[model samples]
Target: MRLRHIAYALLMATALAGCNDTIDGAIDVSKVKNKVEQPLPGRIVAEMQKKNMPRNSPIMIRVFKEEGKMEIWKAKADNRFDKIADYDICAWSGKLGPKVKEGDRQAPEGFYNLTPAHLNPNSKYYLAINTGFPNRYDAVNGRSGSNLMIHGACSSSGCYSMTDAQILEIYAFARDAFRGGQSSVQLQAFPFRMTAENMARHRNSENFEFWKMLKAGYDNFEVTKRPPEVNVCEKKYVFNQQAQGSGQFSAAAACPPMSTPPALTAALASYEKEYQVAYAKAMDKLDGKLWYEPTEAERKAIVAEKRKGRDLAYAPTGTSLAAGKLVEPEEFEKLMAARLAKQTAKPGQILTASTQASAAKQGRVVLPGTAPGNRSTMSVQTAMAAPAPGAAAPTASQTARPQPDMAQATTTGSVPVPAPNPLAYAAVQQPTETEGKKPFWKFW
Candidate 1:
């Protein structure tokens, strides 16, 4: 009788965790409309069997903000997790940073968990899974936000958003995991892949120390290929460890001395050693330059380029900063002027944006969720790439569902039209350097 009561309590807790949204009451998920629930797709079911994952196994999720991907890892027969699928994030608000407070419009970054209560089948934007932001770590660190979610709609305010179809599939994964008796699913969110090279690039970011802490847990999972047990103490995250004494872990209080198994420590140390070497190489290559968003003049140039139909939809790499800080300011201006001169010298360039603007205007971007072959028709072709006057009227493209002003894009924290697309960017062939023109180098 006692065991039964305990189990019921645990189940109730699991059912009620992290649901501070508009959910009224739980509905029977079965016998629902296809919009409210869907069975695992047959293709996914077959992949699970091939990978030795159970139909309703526990799962883990990891999100990369810059990459705009969400990966699902399911438990295999051995109880170890294997990545089952990666879903494209159609939209996520904010630049690469953690949400600090309400109304910041920044998506959160850190460890969170999803429980049965987190699922909202009746969500306004198809189904949704609340992210349970301001987790213990966020709470102790003084972060504030509410109702952040992973949901359908391909839109975002301060949550990871996916296409309606993608979220339906993801919603199925969460539902099945709960049915499998998993109490909660771990959700790890990061600004980008915690690669040493990325770290070196962000070495000067205000959040470097916070990110380094996150990397510890990330490293733990990388070495073991399993989710690390996360606990917060002294307002910091401590992973895969236990207090030395009987002291309880407290998010706001100091962490008691903790201990880890020697084997785990050894593995993590080995991983870190390799990581350190990579970090050194990256730092050396970057040569102490830190990345910043485009300056005022650079953004104006981008605006001008778009007016001339330069395919700012996926602008060439270094075009982000108008080649800022890289070349001396005067030299960079000269570069920009020369490039503009070559562009306006053509008739076709002025005619493209109006034609392109009449496209379906369905918020076209080729991310993981796009049903392949939907790439923007604008691959690199040299047309007359002129610079418009700084005060030129809205481009022909602007007459359609306008791409947000680049400055508003930066201020609002949404990934802009011309932002970096790392997943497929390696295939973007770079332009060759001519005596008067520079090649595209740095990416946004």
Candidate 2:
């Protein structure tokens, strides 16, 4: 009965108001071409060194949906990962929840791993890294999806997409790690950062239990600064646990007796103790609070507007919007204008008439009732800059649309997406690792 209900939900998912994805066929991954990709830009390498991160060290990622941020953490001299940068997510489909079935249109929230074979060099949306969803837990729980990717398109449909400039840097990071003999990279996707306040704010969410299940992994990484060894047993995520006495794990079968590292166990106890106190106080404040839950009319109006918007084109026309969200057009243009400047400052690119014209308004998103940006686009000379070190972050917008950092003007339209096949492009030419130094992730 439970399985039947889920299948029916997937079928009605598009029609239903809460679901964002529509059921689609298996996504074909194009074969990687034998192209010699560019190396990591010199400035990025310098930035890594400034942060005490090796230029080609192993990296881990964490994605927060509500925050619309993707943080890259790299191994340092101590072998513990430290955050290197937080790149804004251009677009991610669906709301704050775990993807339950195929076509739910939800960006998955859980642990994923990517290997060299998963890199799609010749992608329709620039470079892409396949997020290997439906790991043991998803399969055991009967969820279904494919080709859910973290890619270089400023648009999404059941994927976490980013600006082309962003993906270029990101893709190089993974490529360098692989070159340094790192086998795989870990990505932890969450509905939002697992701060107690964030969890409490969404206490009424239908996916709270699942988010809590994911929180264990979130907490593990927080305390240890390492990706937990993710395992699944009895249809649940089991993180950083070693089975007692050679006990193995099977997704659908019962979990064997297991134990966590003593340090993690101790650290987690302290972390949870603090989190619980904060959560309880937050929940108390929520009691009897009068929150702004939009009416049915408002929700429909917003959904209709998104359907008409430019970036939301990849989503199904009938896809529903989540409650209590509205797009802020004015500020979006400013930030996008800034991003365009930075991406375009790439060396040796000739701009033609069409490109120059497109460059004038590259990646502009038009939402209903929102006025176009009156300010002129930043010139190549002006936009080629990053936010100053230790500067305050951008103000949080009501919603984030794909105001792309236009790395190239050609990224505007759809191109031929290649069929998934073996990529040649140097499958694994191991770069010499630092003598006697294993990647920090390998320690755990």
Model 1, position 281, has a per-residue lDDT of 77
Candidate 2 lDDT tens digits, 170-257: 7878887777766668889987788776665554333555776778788878888877777777667777775666566666677787
Model 1 lDDT-worst window of ten: 402-411
CA lDDT, candidate 2, residue 161: 85
Per-candidate TM equals 0.62, 0.62
Positional deviation of residue 267's Cα in model 1 after best superposition, in angstroms? 0.4
lDDT of 2 at 155: 70
Model 1, C-alpha of 360: deviation from truth (Å): 38
**lDDT of every predicted structure (CA atoms):** 0.59, 0.59
Tell me the tens digit of each residue's lDDT in model 1 across 86-166.
976766665567898888778889888666767777789778988877777676667788888998765577888776667
Alpha carbon lDDT at 69, candidate 2? 83
